[model samples]
Target: MAPSSPHRGVQHTLSSRGLAKLALRFFSSLRPTDCPLNCLGKARLDFNLLPLEGELHCLELFQWSLLYQGSKLVATQQSSQTGLQFLHCVMELQKKGIKFINREVESFKNIHLKDGTLEIPRLVILDTAMSLFLNLGAFEQCHFNCGNDTTTYLFFMDDLIDYAEQMRHLHNCGIMRHGLESDAEVADFFNQICKEMVLVSSRSYLSYLSKDVNTYFGNKWNGWIAILELKYFSNPWSIISLIAAFILHLLTLIQTLYGVFGYYRPSS
Candidate 1:
């Protein structure tokens, strides 16, 4: 007789494994009532009774699992004002001395603010991103249990990008990349995606982040520092000119003070 093929042996092993798994599932489904202990006599108990204690324990476990999962999705606290209103465009934030940094993570949920830098996960926009986001937004809206995470992200992005210049700033900062023809298209994509959609910023994951950004932007000192950095510290020549001007003013003040003192005391 010809030797059995190795292929047949492999198929037989897989088939046996499949049968074993099926038998395990089937046996696992049987309750203690369905397959009673052999020691317990039939007259001693009713097989029709449900296992109330085991069922209650299982239900409690399921509820706890859900609560644990929901807690993981929660971020910082809600803002007093609407979070969206506090979010300035990218250019505005840049002008206020807030730096934009690209986070290497793939998840949009990873956006955060630290110090004065806003770190956002890189978003790669393809031709299909619009449809994908729309479907995800629609699904989140229709399903009550599914949180509005995608909707919140879209709205947050929309608030950050009011025009092509803002989108270009985000791109220059490495926070966003797109295959769209122009920056204007990317700007329009975000602007249009969240149109007519109602989002409660207090419930958003980005609420606290937006509030922090606004606080930083509102500080007058940061604006002054930004202006100084832009006007004088941007290049070596500007910095030299500013230093020279400061030295000149200091020398003139010292000369005036020395002359007044010498005249008053008539020099010892």
Candidate 2:
């Protein structure tokens, strides 16, 4: 049997040649890093350097898409065997108030050399505040196309835990139920790609959320109930009226006592 890709941790054990192959596969599945909302390459690369989950993986030469210096990818959460639901899910994601892209990736056509040989992609070691980055290797002669073709060149070979672009796409789809040091660091950066849901909007989905999440929602049910119950009646006049009623009762009590005894009058 062949070794399989570990799906839950960072595997930095690939040989130089293996690493090169992994890099090619990573970029092959991507659009471009320069698009308005491509992956948070810097942070995701940091996280991928930490850990990931994949049962198996294999590298194929660029076969689809226009891989350029400026393009964005659709979220892969919807890229099941069914097809590219990125467009269908995009609006749904937005309806949930997330800030991520709300469109489906039609296709990604990879342009290979006429001789069918992929170039050795460029790899560089770069750094940011407290993290390191494995920059995207360039493909001077390579091209990619992202239209509506729903065929991902990913087949199970050895599961590489740190498949950069794939990991980034998963994160965008809110699949990172967990992460690691470098991955955690790019959290804010990752979150920025998509808008978070409004508190209420997110709550709306809590019904279908995991059991643990639903439990938390149940615990905080009082907060939402309060909002729904009093949201309409919350006004200045209501508050003022309540205060006035209390004062009136106190004044009435004082008058009743004074009239009952007329005060201990001295000779006036």
Best by TM-score: 1
Candidate 2 lDDT tens digits, 1-268: 9666574123434443356446555664343321222365333332333133322122112212222211223322222223211111222222222232212222222211112111111111113311211111112112122222211211100011123443344455433323345543334433331231111111111112222222333444544544543543378776677679879999999898877676665346
Query: Which residue pairs come into collision in candidate 1?
Result: none
lDDT of 1: 0.66
| lDDT for each residue of candidate 1 in 145-241, tens digit (9 for 90 to 100) | 4456677878989989999999888889888888889999999999888894667665566676777888899999999998889889999999999
Sliding window of 10 residues with minimal summed lDDT for model 2: 152-161
lDDT of each: 0.66, 0.30
Worst 10 residues of 1 by lDDT: 42-51
Model 2 has an lDDT value of 0.30
Model 1 ranges off by over 4 Å? 1-71, 74-85
